[model samples]
Target: MQPIDKILRNYQSMIVSGAIILFCVIALIFAVIPSVQKIQEMFVQVSDIAAEAEGLQKKLNVLNALDEQTLRFQLASVLTAVPGDRSFPSLFETVEGVAARTGVVVQQMGLSGGTTLATPSAAKLSAADRKLGARTVPFSVTVNGSISAVQEFITLAPNVRRLLRIRTFAIAFPPDERPLTVSIEMDAFYEPLPTSLGTAKTILPELTAADNEIIERLGNMELITQSAEALPEPFIGQIKPNPFVP
Candidate 1:
């Protein structure tokens, strides 16, 4: 038997309470849910940054183990053995030294077309070819020596100051008391060293067993001059006069 007006007022309050509850649910769906998703995304990004930082720290640690000066010297030796320049005179001197050591006499030498001089065509090469980062310069040389001497020269080619790969070999046995005439075709490779990679970052994954073996082989090479005092002039004198100099 409650008054009708009082019952109506009570119903109004209930409706207001329900409206408030509904508004709160809508806010959670529209606002709070999106905020939670954003927080999760930020957490993922932070995790990625942490992983990247850890990887960089590992790389820095690897670089810390190297002796910068010694690495530079070793790398310089390797690159010098296979120079980026068209240093024909240095190549010739290297060959002559090897022949002398083997008691052989170089009778004739001829360079291939692309190997002798750089032309306009060199600039027009495709991007892929240019990006290969290495080029082969080929040449042919004839020498006169005993078979044993020629064998010794072949054995020693890998240990020479300049990197030369024997591509073709032929021999003509002259009559008795005459030395054997040996013909050799070789490929000299050239690859530029990036300046960004100094002695510390020059090599990655550190030098492996095979890499150390190669370093050992190059280190054993009997260069023309070892002393710092004797290195400059002899090296300067040996390289070809710059063809581009007008």
Candidate 2:
């Protein structure tokens, strides 16, 4: 009876401690571990899915963009000409073609400082073969044509191999004897060589701009974005799931 009592008293604390530890372990495995493991697995799977989807989307975009650019591209071209070598004949010929086709009559053409100088002499020379003036000659072209024909001529002028600019256009609103005749005064600007893109970056003294706000904004870096078209998005999120549970 005495031995049994002594053993029970001394071992009582150990027995209680062991019971508490076992209960905690059971609770952790049943209640906490499953939830933690599920969260970790979900996170890993979601990350993998997101990565795959992103890669696929990028590939599709690249392929589609390539196809579009190759087949149907609409881009503006900056005219390049052999500056001083450009002659009035070629420029005049281009105007003549457009004007004649559009039913515009050229009454008088001359070479002058501004875009408008009526030059009848340019008709005799060839485009690549003629030189209107040394370096850049300011010439004027006067055409007796309708408003539509005049507009067509201006549009066609830039498409010519030799660069020409519409410095000023003066239309006969009240008009002379010919009511449909609108006089166009344009400058045929020719340089020695097509100015380099880098050199063109700088506005030269001879170069001129119009009061039109749109033209003033052309090639202005302050008004433009110079970064690459295609770029990557930055890191957005970082989520960590329980490691021990998995």
lDDT of 1 at 154: 83
Task: Please provide, for model 1 over 141-224, each residue's C-alpha lDDT reduced to its tens digit, 9 standing for 90 to 100.
Answer: 899999899999888765676778887899999879899999998866565433244443233566889998888787777664
Q: Per-prediction TM-score, please?
A: 0.74, 0.34
Candidate 2 residue runs with Cα over 4 Å from true position: 1-80, 83-86, 114-135, 175-177, 193-246
Candidate 1: misplaced stretches above 4 Å? Answer: 1-8, 116-134, 195-205, 224-246
Q: What TM-score does candidate 2 get on C-alpha atoms?
A: 0.34
Q: Which residue window of length 10 is worst by lDDT in model 2?
A: 71-80
Model 2: how far is 121 from its true place, Å? 23
- lDDT string, candidate 2, 11-130, tens digits: 989878989999999989997899899999999999999987776677566555555442221111112222233345555565666567666787777765433243333323434225
Q: lDDT (0-100) at residue 121 of candidate 1? A: 31
Which is the leading candidate under TM-score? 1
